[model samples]
Target: MSFHFEYPRTIAARRPGEFKPAAPKFHVRWQAPVTTIVSDYIAVQRQASDMAAERAFFQRMRRAFDSAYGPDSFEEMRQTDEAGMVNSIVVAYWTDIVRYALWKHVDSFNAWFRSTEREQEAVGYWRETLTVPYDRMETIFSEPYYHAGLARTRQAALEPMYTAGYFGAMRDRLPISAIDPLNSPYGETTPEGNYAGGPVRRVRVDVPPNVVSIRSGQVWQKAEGEQLDDYYQNLQPKLETGMAYLKEHPETTGYLSLRAIVHLDKDGQELRETSKHGYFLALAQLERWAAEHKSHLDIFKHALAMRRKYGADRQVVTWHEVFVLGTTPSLEYINCHPGTGLLRFANVWGNPPPSN
Candidate 1:
């Protein structure tokens, strides 16, 4: 079924001609290497008491980005939950990965992370960074004007290619048959020549008739050898069940779409990572899903229990940030790619090119 969004109209009305129609065409885009995505999870223990400081901290971060890379170099979005958790994500496209690496070591950049105030505050801070080469990535824009995610870099118009069904969209990107088990570009290889990397997982479920929702995330083990082996063996089954449940009951969940990807290192490795990253289309759905589903709760309780058992020093730190739709200037939309997150609901918020 076709999903409809109410805000695009409101957004358009507010901005007047900003959302006006553009040319009707399909396109393929490539992000220059080494493209990087940085996500920061900032949580205040006392929400009411620390709200002001949290906001100020975020503002300071914005200023830092502006001063270091110019306003247009990056895009940022913030999401806050009822439980007082806050997640801010910044996505920047770099023409050169070496430059991006150098900037991180700059005095001011290093100082921001080392700030004594941040360290002493009750707030917790964690960051994940991922850098990927251009050829290792793929992007599709359903219309000529829409641009978001990796599409933020370069785009070229292409002929329209429709999918046969829900899975077809994913197949268009990388056919299941062509997916290289040994040397997938999606992740890095281990010393043993095994693909021991974290790659984004995409799930698609039918909304009925003419629409579908796509959800994507990353899966990785926190520790090496036995610990990592046990983590995936246990987590994979639960993830499958969760995806099935979500597709089976979408209405009660408000689960339009979701994406949870862990940022990888510059070499595309995620070995023994301490933190993870994710973005949700709707925070309410996540809350509802977690509260109502035992599996979801089990995952949470298990993680907490494991941490307690192992102690903080040995346990993995997990955190996520949610983005407010359209708030990120860098998240510009030109068109909707079929069966992609949020893009599936483009019927509501998307601006389709003018019909010939």
Candidate 2:
């Protein structure tokens, strides 16, 4: 790997001769290592036919989350998955897992989640959370700009990345990958959903080994005038198109599930911010898609163009957190439309590259 300067790290362990990335990039450095970080994605959804009810449920939950975690930052987003369901999501992050535990038990929030009324409503509810140790997560940044996503540390720093922007780079960036091949399991990949048109069927998913999940965030809130127009008119639309492809062709791309989300306000209304949280069977599959897919390549080119134009003054921030989850990632959906997120490959999905 090649770097123009040196900086502290908030990335995974590095490897040997065959391990070091020949093409170097940049990443972030947190204040200190977080032993465990918990990310919770709370989603409230309903069918396209029940738009009014769904928005109501979304606002109610948003109010509940705001009251439960007053000072902490909770990012809100909207998702339309492949199930023909409209979902409103609130993403909460806890650097210390213990704090998350306290928040989870908040009386009002818990009551809402456990209430019998939820079974009666047309709206569906789901939360897909994953708690991972420090070593399992890998992060990278193109420039020393914004600390988007989980990199929102108290005072984050930026460092050079030796292993990124190329094929097999994610595996090289992961410290655990040095020892564990981080491959996916091969087994029965059938789903287990009670799709009998019930309003209260809750299914808990068992995450297969080495399943790679990523939260790629892009915030154009700081852009203005021409930059703003470019982002909304060209950049963001491109991102949405790519996300749709990933959602539609999961088997071809090794993407089990994907969500293109827009930010929400206190009133649960959508804003300019956006992000994509995706899941793949293995790190290698994700890398292949990023490095080989034309869809991703277009996104990559547009990013470079914007970065070059603005240089350090760029208001647009792009970042992503890549985590190879340990088994038992918490993925649950209640009354959700069928085939919602990781549900498609319920019985231990494996990481086999799509047929060429």
Candidate 1 per-residue lDDT, tens place, 1-356, comes to 21111111211111223332232223333322233332222222234445565456556655655544322244444334323444333445444544555555652744665454544555544332333332222333323343334434433223333321121222223221133221212122111111111221211121121111221322243455654665667654565566556645656544444333233333323333222223233334544576668767666566545545554333233322222222211121111123333334334433334333
1-356 per-residue lDDT for model 2 (tens digits): 21122224444443444555433446755666557677778778876667677567656656765654431356767787766677877777677766667667663776778666876666778888888876677787765666566656544567766675445666766667656767667432313333333332665667777778898888777789998899889888788778777766655566777777877776666766777888877776666677788878889889778766877777777778888998747887777766777654434332233232
TM-score of each: 0.39, 0.78
Task: Please give the distance, in angstroms, between residue 188's alpha carbon in candidate 2 and its true position after superposition.
Answer: 13
Best by lDDT: 2
Rate residue 90 of model 2 by lDDT. Answer: 74
Model 1 is weakest, by summed lDDT over 10 consecutive residues, at 188-197
* Pairs of residues clashing in candidate 1: 1-208, 5-348, 145-334, 146-333, 146-334, 146-335, 147-333, 147-334
**How does candidate 1 score on lDDT?**
0.36
Model 2 residue 293 lDDT score: 82
